[model samples]
Target: MKDLIKESISDLKKSDGFVYVTAEGEKIDLHEAAAKGIAVTPVNPKSEVIKKLEAAGLDLTDSKFLNDLNELISLLSGSGSTKGKSGKRRTFSDSEKSKIVEEWKKVEAAGKKTKAAFAREIGVGYQTFINWLRD
Candidate 1:
């Protein structure tokens, strides 16, 4: 089972995600790296531990579950409310915003109605198109 845990950790790291680990004593910490998100689930922490994780609410499904959770946590961490450390909201400069608007106008001249529609016509997501417009 130790090998299985290690293999799972390897897989998670490769996928830029995390896994549970109890190898180093009883300590469990959420480790995040640019390569991936990782959660070391302590070995034999207790059956109730799993229940607690579930009760606290988590997907726990296979695939990118660990990655998704870690990513969400990281995102929240930057948003300030996660730890009561507020940060400035993102804002685009006028020139950049103007560029986006100009590009949108050009696309509009070619007969685009909405950002999503324009994005579809140009092979991108609606949000991407909006971002381009707001450059």
Candidate 2:
């Protein structure tokens, strides 16, 4: 029975998508696995064997399960736009702002055309430059 179960688990790992079998021999799909909060891989963790193991009362807190769950959560949540404290809102000094504005005027006078192009050259967003002009 143990060997059979192990073989089933191995088969489950090899199969595609999230699969969970209820103790009563019912199959669970990806949507069901997600709804049940089962630890599944980020790239479709469903499998028939998984469903069977789950139905057989698989340990949800198993180390491998937790690790996979954490990885999936991280992948789903994204890496975030900000990078630590350095990405926090910044307060530009008056001199820096003036310098930027002056550079922007030179670009404008030089017929750089697109505001976005000039903004890119100066390493700032076009909207940011517009906001500076408004200030």
Candidate 3:
């Protein structure tokens, strides 16, 4: 199983088009983002935030209100935003990636459990780990 897993990881690393590319429209850092991967998407005009902004009729032309509205959204979005303190997504370094793979191996050797369980136990989202492994 370990050998198969190693081979699978190797194959995943070698055979990637895109994994973590789905994102709502925001162009601020798209230059940097493209190197990671480009996703096909529109600005999601029907999203909850958009609906609220439209219903409230807040003038988004005002920069001050944008920040205020953002804060309000964060407050409403509950606590699933555990990626970073400031609500930004987290990135892993090469050394961190190596450490995570080692830990994954150790866990796999310890017993038979689902990857989702391992992810929940370790506090890393399963999809996020899979995305990193692909990259």
TM-score of each: 0.26, 0.34, 0.32
Name model 3 segments beyond 4 Å from true. 1-86
Reference-based lDDT, each prediction: 0.52, 0.62, 0.57
Model 3, 43-128: lDDT tens digits are: 33223333444455655568888877676775577423333356355577899877887787787888776677766554578998
lDDT for 11 in candidate 1 is 47
Expressed as tens digits, the lDDT of each residue in 1-135 for candidate 1 is 455445445544543233345445333354532235543453443333444455556445544787666657766665212333234444556786576678779877887476775554434456766766564
- For model 1, the stretches where C-alpha displacement exceeds 4 angstroms are 1-88, 116-135
Residue-level lDDT of model 2, residues 1-135, one tens digit each, is 487487786655765654455555455565776798764433333344455566777655488876666566655675222223243556678899899888878878988656776655545667887898888
For model 3, what is the C-alpha lDDT against the true structure?
0.57
TM-score winner between 1 and 2, please give it: 2
